[model samples]
Target: MFFGSRKGSEHNSGQDKVISMDRFRDGSSLSPIRQAEAYWTALRQGEDVPKRSQIDPRGLENILSQTFILERIAPGIARFRLAGQKLNEMAGMEVRGMPLTAFFTPTARKQVSAALEHMFDAPAVVELSLQTEATRNRPSQEARMLLMPLRSDLGDVSRALGVFVSEGNSMKTSQRFNVTATELRPVTPLLKPKMSPASKSPNEVNAGFAETQAKFSDEPSVMDEARALVEASRQSMDEARKSLSEIGKPTEKTKPSRSSHLRLVVSRD
Candidate 1:
């Protein structure tokens, strides 16, 4: 379960440049913090954020459970949010259920965990900063974060849509950036979108059902709305004219399914 959801922007979308904040290169234009927000806005608008099912692995669900999509996934731990290519060369691995503390320098670990805790406890989108020693020998590195909550069918905080951005200056005469700061934000499950149900079965209320779902509505959070969507999805998938009257379309197909929250994935060397 990806904590934050969105797709990749591997293709040159020109949107990346919109958030680059080149003026920050001179330390004269934007604060690293502000730059991160601008970048996040661009990504959210570009529609480049990938969903959990598209990129992240299942083992991410454990620590992910304690967090909603509106919460931060933290800096050191393996993060499930699908981000852009700037982090491509980034390399690390995770052992399921491990707290992020085990993966960072002492100072980095302490500061980051606290910042993250505050973000989660409040259960709203918040901005926080942290220090890390994970860089290629940099003395001090700052990261910025944006944590926004997503809702499932239960009317509670379910997941989040997040964004992470690093700030830096362009190396003289080159395109390389020497990152000095980073930022993150949660975007989705914020404004509701039409829910796409995984599977549907009618007359089997206790049978396979949607674990999370929601209907399209404004001024509403989806966490509790998932139940309604599940029922609608059930009718849409298995019932004939009922759905046609609701959606003006005929039923497709409904199949039995179950939820798998976590699993291990091995790769061949």
Candidate 2:
């Protein structure tokens, strides 16, 4: 399927710095996930996350079963949490004590290497189609995989987390996420009369550059920009927060529709 659903994750290894505690304590409007989101915002912005090895597996185990299949895929690879016996069997046999390279057929192995490398190279989520044992060695029935990086507090790439989402005949749609934002020089054509530093002089061209330079001086550093980009992600994540709120709202006894069953996955890179 060309179109697929979007997935997300939260990094809660560190203290809950990013979350809003007030609303949560009173159990007013904000939910646990929302409060946890604050922690996630800080994590995304480069706050130190405890090493996974240092983390209590049991502490996260309950969250894992509720979310993804949380076993290590290889030396530095982990699969997004998956459910059911099939996933467990696959992990048990080849992925646990092995490098991910072991699972791919030789030709596919090369591709897997490249894909995993790409995940390490960037902090964005990547999607691809892959063959699985469940496919019966046939060409069709491929599982869609999304590779995301999990990082350490030092801002180094830690583990690459991937999700193998199955797509049947139905259509799939994947939402695009902005992992990083670059500082770009403004070009005239795309320019609108947005707010700029106050500078009025006869020579407009030189004045514009001078003003831009000054603005940059007062603006965020590269590190701060990184923080903003991560904080900005909260806007995108608000959708999930809203869903959780609706779920928590008291209502007549009824199971929510699959319309709300949309699954969102995130590889903490």
Candidate 3:
């Protein structure tokens, strides 16, 4: 008795269910940042942070151009210990020995400084979303940056491994970026503490299916006891046989006796 458009209803339902999944995909444009973070995480192993000396250029060959190493010279201040060609290109000069704040605009420098301080102090992972101001000749660009804390040879969290990736066309002049967002993630230890023997109970210390009240002793085994019993039985049997033989034979104190009256009886037909 009711008239309805089934096809139209189904089409509307399908349209409503449509969802954008691009955010879940690892896009090519942001591959460098992901690669750098993955490499750092792998190097950490079970430690809070990886050592600076443990970093190898070979491990990050594909993203080497976008990678850089930072050394914390002072609180909230770090300079490029080593920088890649990509960073150099963006700065329009060699970025080594230059402060990381040089890559950011004046307004964003304080935020970057605070983030850097937190990264070295808290020794946490830092990520920054960045953008460039558009001009009449240059278009605005978006970028992502990652900073992972590292320990120096002396075992101090003053070193960092970092990566910078920018999207869209590159500017001919030096391009400074503004910090749009910052993310700080605390690092966790990968290894768990072991339980000491003192912490375990006496029963738990023994590694068997059943518990026994018997104390440990230097006694012989069950096989040894069985062997001893067998030896004693054999000696008793030998003694009995010897006694029978001695009784049957004439002894020094007894005179020889005549043979018994029993005769051998054999029946042959």
Candidate 4:
């Protein structure tokens, strides 16, 4: 479920040197947003909300720095359990223990909070279109945010997995994103996967039959090899007895040879 990308490098004058901009793509074209969406979807498998344990950092290596995790502390409130480097760069500080709404502009804070509540309640995925504030030196920058519900170790819907990415230069200072647009997609756990008989493989179908046959088959085959060996042994013993009986019985004896009395008497002399 990994998306392929063609990466190109960009040189900056700041401390961040040799920045690699990877262009991820689906079947259509390169898109980091689509890559994030696909990654989130794969993590869920068939469940509505993926368990926090199911997440592996290596799986999202392409977007590792862009990912973060939030712990829902109360209703309509979530604090960061983990924040990635990309997010910290945007905030210009350590974001751990900070509210998720802290990254949003003041005007968009309420809407973003409401959306966070919906994400936990519906256990759905939320995608946000964000814009950074405009200033004389720094212009307005656009970004995308993806939030998906995650189940905590206590089996509560209080955790969320998220990814945030901006399509501009890295922010040197704290930047708040204004939620210009938001999309909420409802998701439900696949209750029962369709058990299609037509799709069953031959090995799978025979596995049950094999166990059943092994259980009910009590009759053992006759040992033909033993019988054949016993028969051959009996035949050999009969032939031996015949030869012994023949040897014991009287027969026409052959005459002794005339040369039997001859000997070399003076051989050693």
Candidate 5:
């Protein structure tokens, strides 16, 4: 199922604005938009943004299929690495590997591209209110798109974590939306405190050590590499052992051929 896979909730009224800080703190609305926002907040914690490797689809199960992950392939260009079924249905195509601009109208593509760049360069979160042009065949739509920067595995701010929600009937044809309104919030990176030379706090040293370990441990690929190496070594040793074991194995003796003793004669007429 694509965009219309699930029946949207009644409260998804599509009229609600991005939740405010006060509303967020007071636990006001439980709309899909707010749910997406809260999940992104929890993932980041105190960091500038969460890393690509840190995201767990299971943790975002509620909105899992409504979310997307994009990677900046070049300046002013982003390709979708993962897209939800809703997005696919809206585009009327498989959206993964497609540029984000593909979903927007020609007139609004530049604006959409600029917003994407700002999300990466400012390392910020952006929320946009979107609407598709109405036609006899396709009805208008009201949608919300949230874009948040994410640290790539190589430590660059080139990945985007996004969630999209729309309140309306799904279109029969591909939909092209325009950004009606946008809100951007800049995020500050959390820096580690420096220790003075004279003080040389032991706690600071321990913290630094733990941080270094965490940097490497956060990527599961490292552990995968180690496991692969161990498995290869074990296989090699097993092969070597088999070769050694076969060296002195006894061999079966063959019976002498009776054909050697038999002679065949042919007489000519």
Candidate 6:
């Protein structure tokens, strides 16, 4: 009951713009793949990758059964953190916690791992065409799968949004798919907004400090005041020198001769 598988088929791999649903034929059974992609794209809203938390199942109501979320545990390896009913039916059991490679043939597992690595490393969008072989009681089936990078709550590109849709009758047994073609589209990050300069104020001084209220004046500078003080000091020093010179010289020796010629009387004490 597995999907169709063929050997020696060339894989069509390319880098292109975001895929458009209109590019596929109208009423294609794999349209759900494109629908899921479209939902992820809309969530991007100009971002390189949409946040995993931004994913709302309500937006994907129509294709919810085919959508799953993946958490990258290592390079070239990812496991299903959340899977839809279709995946469970394909695996004939709950597919949660299972590696994505489980859904692919052993030979195709390498290709699937490479695709997962590219989607997470390049942070690109990936689409794969899968085919499963028919058994005696089952018919061959064709499927389309989409993997889009998403940012986790921590802003790391460790999570992905995926959709897997197959065209054919439901299988009672577990199934696996073979990679036939792959398309990779590298994403462009959004540019940050630039900051504008602050507007100039009439007053040159900044407004917050206490000095903001001080006015500019044309008063003498500090050098001018220093020169005036020096001149005053020099004058005082010159006057003090002259006064000392006068005191040092002989002064008015004959002025008190007449009145000072007093008789000297010796008195017994």
**What C-alpha RMSD separates each model from the true structure?**
35.6, 42.3, 12.0, 15.6, 26.6, 18.2
Alpha-carbon local distance difference test for all models: 0.41, 0.42, 0.86, 0.80, 0.80, 0.83
Tens-digit lDDT string for candidate 3 (169-195): 465578899999999998888776687
Candidates ranked, most accurate by TM-score first: 3, 4, 6, 5, 2, 1
Instruction: Extract clashing residue pairs from model 5.
Output: 3-86
Predicted candidate 5 versus true structure: per-residue lDDT over 1-269, tens digit per residue: 11322246575555444434675553336566678777777787678888889888877776776799999998888999999887887888899999998989998888888888899998888898999998887667789999888999898999988888876345445888999998988987656668565466433334442442222234568889999999999999999999999999987888977665667889997
Q: Write the per-residue lDDT of candidate 6 for residues 123-214, one digit (tens) a residue.
A: 89999999998789887888889999999999999999999887533655889888999999997875655633244443456555445545
lDDT of 4 by residue, 14-67 (tens): 333344344333222545467766776777767777789988887777677888
The whole-model C-alpha lDDT of candidate 4 against the native structure comes to: 0.80
Q: How many clashing pairs does model 2 include?
A: 17
Candidate 3 lDDT: 0.86
**Regions more than 4 Å wrong, model 3:** 1-30, 191-269
Q: Estimate the TM-score of every prediction.
A: 0.30, 0.33, 0.62, 0.60, 0.58, 0.59
Lowest summed lDDT window (length 10), candidate 2 = 179-188
Global CA lDDT computed for model 6: 0.83
User: What are the per-model numbers of colliding residue pairs?
Assistant: 30, 17, 0, 0, 1, 7
Model 2 regions lying over 4 Å from their true place: 1-86, 91-94, 132-139, 167-269
Segments in model 1 whose C-alpha atoms lie over 4 Å from true places: 1-81, 91-104, 134-139, 167-269
Model 5 regions lying over 4 Å from their true place: 1-29, 189-269
In terms of lDDT, which candidate is stronger, 2 or 6?
6
| Maximum-lDDT candidate | 3
**Which is the winner by lDDT between candidate 2 and candidate 3?**
3
Output the better candidate (3/5) by TM-score. 3
